[model samples]
Target chain A: MTYSTMKPKEVRQLIREKKITTFTSGLCNGYAQANLAILPKELAFDFLLFTQRNPKPCPVLDVTEIGCPEPKLAAPGADIRYDIPKYRIYRYGEMTDEVTDLSTYWRDDLVAFLLGCSFSFEGPMLDAGLEVRHITENHNVPMYITNIPCTPAGVFSGPMVVSMRPMKPKDAIRATQVTSRMPSVHGAPIHIGNPTDIGIKDISKPDFGDPSTIYPGEIPVFWACGVTPQAVAMSVKPEFMITHAPGHMFITDLLNADLSVL
Target chain B: MTYSTMKPKEVRQLIREKKITTFTSGLCNGYAQANLAILPKELAFDFLLFTQRNPKPCPVLDVTEIGCPEPKLAAPGADIRYDIPKYRIYRYGEMTDEVTDLSTYWRDDLVAFLLGCSFSFEGPMLDAGLEVRHITENHNVPMYITNIPCTPAGVFSGPMVVSMRPMKPKDAIRATQVTSRMPSVHGAPIHIGNPTDIGIKDISKPDFGDPSTIYPGEIPVFWACGVTPQAVAMSVKPEFMITHAPGHMFITDLLNADLSVL
Candidate 1:
C-alpha cells in the first residue's frame, strides 16, 4: 500500500505481525515518526533529564512509565515493542543484533522514550518548497559528529550528532523559518555554511548515512540529529539498550502539524 | 542607574516616575519585559484564543483578572496602571494619546494582558554572542505586515506582524536554535530571507520601525513580532484599547534567563 493513502495504525499493525520489516521513512506521510530508546527502569529520571538538557537532539515526544509497552500520548493503541518495523539491540554500547520484532526480548524493568525525529519536519520542509538534499539524491542525509557537547545527566553524555541538508542559500533561509515552527522535531538548523566552523573536517565523509550532493550556490544546513541520543547511549555504555535501527523508525499517531507552536 | 545594577523594583519605581519615558529596551536588563495590551472585558476570550492561535506573535505572558490591576504571574507587586514607562491609548483603532501613567484612564471593565516580548530573548542572544540588529544599529527592529493571516478567534483578527533581523547565515541558524528553546518569547522565526516569500514587497521599506542594513552574505531573519496584538487591537476596534508605545514596554519581575527552556 502507498504511504500517502495509509493511516499510521494500519501501517503499525502490519509491522506488528512481522509482515513488514523495512524503513519507516515516507510511511504514513503526514504522521509523526519517532526514535525509540528503551532503557532499564533505574535510569528513567536521569535519562529524562538528559533529554531535557539536550532538547534539540533528544526532544521528548513522549515517555511511558516503567515497564509499559504503550506510548500513551503518541500512540495510544500501538504496542511499542511490535509497532516498529525494525529494532536494534545494544549490549554494553555495542550493537548486538537487529531484529524485526522484540516480543522475545521484552522485559518488565524497562522504560521507553519516544523522541522527535527529523521525519516530522521534513514533510513540512518539502511542502514549503525547500529541497531536502537526501530526497533529491536518493541517499541518506549526511550526519557529522559536532564538537558541541550535550548537557549530561547521569551517565548519558556525549557530543551532538547533526544531520546536514544542502540547499540553495535562499532555501536554507526558508527551511529555517519552516522548521522553526515545530520545536518537537528538532526545530531549525543548528548550523549553516562553513563546515570547519563547527569542527567538521570533511563534508564528504559523514559518520552515518550516505552523503548527498551539495551543488553550487547551495550551503549545508545542519540540524540537531536524533542520532545524538543513540550516540549518547553508546557513549554511556548502558548495560543494555534497545532502539529502532537507522531509518527504521516507530510510526506515531501524532499529526506532524499538531506539534506546531502556533 | 546602570540596568545591571538596578533591581526589578527599582526599575519599576523609575518607570513610574515618568522621567525614563523613552524606549524600555535594554533597561531593567535581566528582568522580564512585556508587551502590554488592554481591552474591554467583552473582547478578552477571543483575544485569549487569538494569542493561543498566534502564540509567537502574541505570547500570553500573564493575564490579569477583569478589574484587577495585578499580574500575579509576572509582577506581583506592580500595578497595571502607572507602572509601565509609557502607554498609547486608542479610540476606535486610532491612537489618541500617549501617557506614562494610566491612573486617569483606569476602569474596572478592562482586562490587561502582558505578553512576552523579544526583549526577553535579546539578552540571551547578546550573551550568546549574536548581535540584535536593532540594538547594534540604534533603531527599532524593522517590522512588516505579513500576508500570513493569524488564525482568527471570534471577532479579533489581523495579519501577523514580524520583526526582521539580518545576520550572517550561521548567526541566523544559531538564532533559530537559540529562540526555539524559548517558547514563551516568540519561540522562533516565522520566515527567513526573500521577503517576497512571505509577501513583503520591499526589504528597505518596512511597514514599521527603521529599515535595517542587510550586509552581503547575510540573511534577513524574521520573528513573529510582539507588535501583533496592537495590530489586532486596531483591527478589532474595541470601544477602548491601550498598549505600550512602539519602543516603550512594561518591565516585569521575572528574570530573563529563567525563561530559557534548556
Candidate 2:
C-alpha cells in the first residue's frame, strides 16, 4: 500500500496485528505523531501540571480522561496500548521490557497522555525547504542532556534534554520563526548557535542518536527535546511507567496544520 | 511599598486613586496586566474570532459580556473606565482624543476585552536576566508595520505589527524560550537578526516609538506586538474603538508571575 493514502487507524490496525512494528515516522505524512506516556490515575494530575508547567519539553497533544485509553483530540476510536508500534514498560524507573503489544499490561487505572512530538514541526520545516537532519540521515536527531531544569511538579523534577541539529545561522533564525507558530510541538529552539553554552560538553557524542555534520559556519541549534518529560518521569521512579520506546511514536488522526497558531 | 511587597489588587487601587499612574511597569510585579480594547458589541464576535484565529498576535485574556465592563479573569471588581492610567478613543478608526477616563464614552453595548501584552512576559524575562531593551532605555520599544498578513475574521484584517528590541543572539534565544512559556502574552520573538527580513525598511525610524541604540554585538529581535489588533481594528475603519495609549496601559489586579506556565 502507498504511504500517501494510508490512514492512521489503518496503520494502527497493522501495528495491532503485529504486521508493522517498526518506527512509525514519515507514515501518514500530514497527521501528527505523538509521544505516549501512560501513568496511574493518582499521578495524572501532577503529570498534567508538569506538562502544563514545562510545556516546551512536554507539549501535551491530548490526555485521555482517567481510566480511558482513547485520546479524543488526537486520535479517536483508537486504542492507546495497541495502536503504537512499540512500548516500553518500566518498574521503579527501570526498563523492564519492550513490547509490540500492551493488551496484557493495560490497566483501567492508567491515564494516557499523547504529547506533541518534533515530527509535527518537522513537516512545516521540511515544507519551508529546510532539511531535517534526522530525515536526511534516516536516523533519529541527536539529543543531549542539558543543564536546564524542568519546572518541578509533584514528583516530577529533572534536567531538560534537548535535540540538536546543525544549521546555518540564517536557517536557524528562519526555523525559530516558523516553529514559534506551533507552541504545542516544542514551539521554538531553546538554544541556538552554541551547544556548549547549554552545558553539552561534547557535541560529537550525544546522549541519544547519531551526531550530524556541522559544516563550517553551520551552528548547532537545540530545541527542548520531548525526552525531558520521559526523563523526569523516570527520575520520579514511578513504580510503573509506560512509554513508547525511542523512535516509535503514536500516530494521531489530527493533522499537523491544526496545531499551528497562525 | 516595595514592588515585591505590594499585592496586585492594592496596586490597582493605587492606580485608580491617581496616586500611581506612572508606567505601571514594575508594579503588580507578578500578575498579568492585560492590553485593553473596548469595542462595540456589533464587532465583538468577529473580533473574538480574530483573536482566536490570530492568537500569536492578539491573545484574548478575557472578554466582558455586552455592556458589562468587568474582566472577571484579569481584574475583577475593577473599573475598566478608570483603572487604566490613560486611554485613546478612535472615531472611525482614527485617533480622536486621549483621556484619563472613559466614563462619558462608555456605552451599554461596549464589550471589554483584556488581551495579553508583552508586559506580562517582561517580568519573566527580567527574572530570567534577559534585559528588555525598551525598559532599560526608558523609551517605548520600536514597532514596525510588518509585511506579515494577519488571519482575517469578518471585517477585521490587516498586516501584523511587531515590536523590536536589539539583543545578543544568546539573549534572543533565551527570549524565545522564555516568552514561549507565556502563550497568553505575545510569545517569543517572531524574527531575529535582520530588520529588512520582515519588511522594515529603516531600522532607525520605527513606525512607532523611540528607536534605541543597537550596539555592535546586538541582534534585532521582533515579537508580534499587541498593537496588531488595534492596527487591524483601525484598518477596517471601526466606528468607535478605545485603547490604552502608548505606555499608558490598563493596570490589572494580576501578577506577572500568575501568567507564567511553569
Candidate 3:
C-alpha cells in the first residue's frame, strides 16, 4: 500500500505496530506533520513560555496534558509514545538512545509538546509553484545558527536556528506571501538575502543538514527551523529530553489548509 | 494634559503614581492595551495551556517569569505591580479587594500573563469607518456567557465568554476583514446573526457589561472576550488569582499595528 495516500490514522496505526520505522516525510500528503518535544512537568511551564515568547521559531500546535501521552487537540486518540516513526532520547543533552517506541521510558510526570513543522508550510510553497530546492534535490534543507538570539524564558536560551532555501528574487517575494498566511507554522522568511547580515559565516557550509545548490542570481531565504527547541535543549542540557529524529515527525489529522490564518 | 496624546511610558508613569486611576479605554490611543491575569506558580502551567488552547478568547501577549513583576516583552522597564490603573484580587474565587497597586499582594511564586484585549482591534474598526456602538453610546460592550465550552487544559475548564456588537450585515463583513488581520487580539467574530444558536437567550440583557442599542435591521456579532480567563478562574477556584478590573487595562508600548499578522 502507498503510505502517502493513506489516512493519518492508518499510518499512525502501522507505526504503532512497529511496522514503519523510517522518516514520515511525504506520507499522508496534505496533512499537517509535527515535531515532538517531551519534557518533564517541571520543565514544561518554562519551555512553554519560551515557545510563547519566540513564536516564529517555535509555533506550538498542541500540548498534551501533564503525564498524558495523547495529543488530544492535534490528533485525538493518537498516542505520542508510539505514533511517531522514530524517537531520539537524550540525557543531560547527550544522545542516550534511539528507539521506535517510548513505552519503556514513559513516565507519569512527562508532558509532550507538539510543535508546528516547516513541512506543513512546504506543501503550500510547492502549491504556490515555488521550487523548494531541498525536496527537488532530495537532500536535507540547509540550516544555520544565526546571530539572532531568541527571547529567553526561564532557563531556556539560545540563538535562533533557521532553515534556508535558495530561490530567485521574484520567487522569494512570492514565497513570503505564500508562507505568511500560515503563522501556526514558521511564518514568512526571516531573511531574504545577504546571509552575512544575520552572521552566517559561509553560504556553502551549514551547522546542520546538507547544503542545497544556489544557482546564479538565486538568493537564500531563511525561515525559523523546528530544530530550535532541540538546540535550546542541548544548550540547557536538561536531565532528560525526548524529540523526534531529524526529518521524522508525527502526522496529524488536520489538513494543511486548516493551518492557514487567512 | 491630553492623555490620548501621551506616550505609553508617560501614561504608565502617571498610572504608577496613581494620578490616573480611571478606565484606560482611550488612553494611549494607538497603542495596544492588555488584560492582566496573575496566578501562582502551581497553577501557571495549566493556565498557560488554557490560553494556548483557546487563542480566540485568551490571546496571550506576554508572560512574566515566575516571581517577576515586569512584563518585559509588552513594556520593558514598566512594573506590573503599579502600572495598571486597577486590579481585582480574588481569593479562592471570591472577590476580596479592588486596588490600584499589587505590591502588597504580590508573591514570589506568582506569574503574570498579559493578554491581548479587544481594544487593540477597535481602533482599526473605527478607522475603517465602522461604528462601534459601545464607544458611541458611552457604555460597556455587551458580554454574554455562551454554551460554547473552551478546550479544557489541566484543572482549567469553563464556558467561553463573548462580547457582542450589533452591526449591519455589510459592516459585519467589513469588520471581520479588519479584525482578521489582528489575530493576537481575538481575531474575527466567533458567530454572527443568531443569539440562541450559541445559547444566548436574551439579546437585551447581558451576563456582564452593559447592553448597547441594537438598531433594527442590524445583526448581533460576537467576538471572543478577554474575560474568559477570569471566568475560568472563578470556575476552577484556584487558591489565589489577580486580574485587571473591567475597563481598566495595562497599556503596552506596542502599537496596535504591531499586533496584526498581515
Query: Number of the top candidate by lDDT?
Result: 3
Q: What is candidate 1's lDDT per residue for B17-74, written digit by digit as tens?
A: 7767777766766888888899887776557646655667987667776777877667
List of clashing residue pairs for candidate 1: none
- Number of backbone collisions per candidate, in order? 0, 7, 0
The reply for model 2, stretches above 4 Å from the true place, is B1-262
Off by over 4 Å in 1: B1-28, B31-262
Ranking by TM-score: 3, 2, 1
Task: List TM-scores for all candidates, in order.
Answer: 0.56, 0.57, 0.97
**What is the lDDT, from 0 to 100, of the residue B27 in candidate 2?**
65
Most accurate candidate by TM-score: 3
Model 2 scores a TM of 0.57
Query: Best to worst by DockQ, what's the order?
Result: 3, 1, 2
Better of 1 and 3 by lDDT: 3
Instruction: Count backbone overlaps in model 1.
Output: 0
What digit string (tens of lDDT, one per residue) describes model 3 on residues B86-193?
999998999999999998999999999999988888889999999999999988899999999999999999999999999999999999989888777898899998
Chain A: TM-score in each model: 0.96, 0.96, 0.98
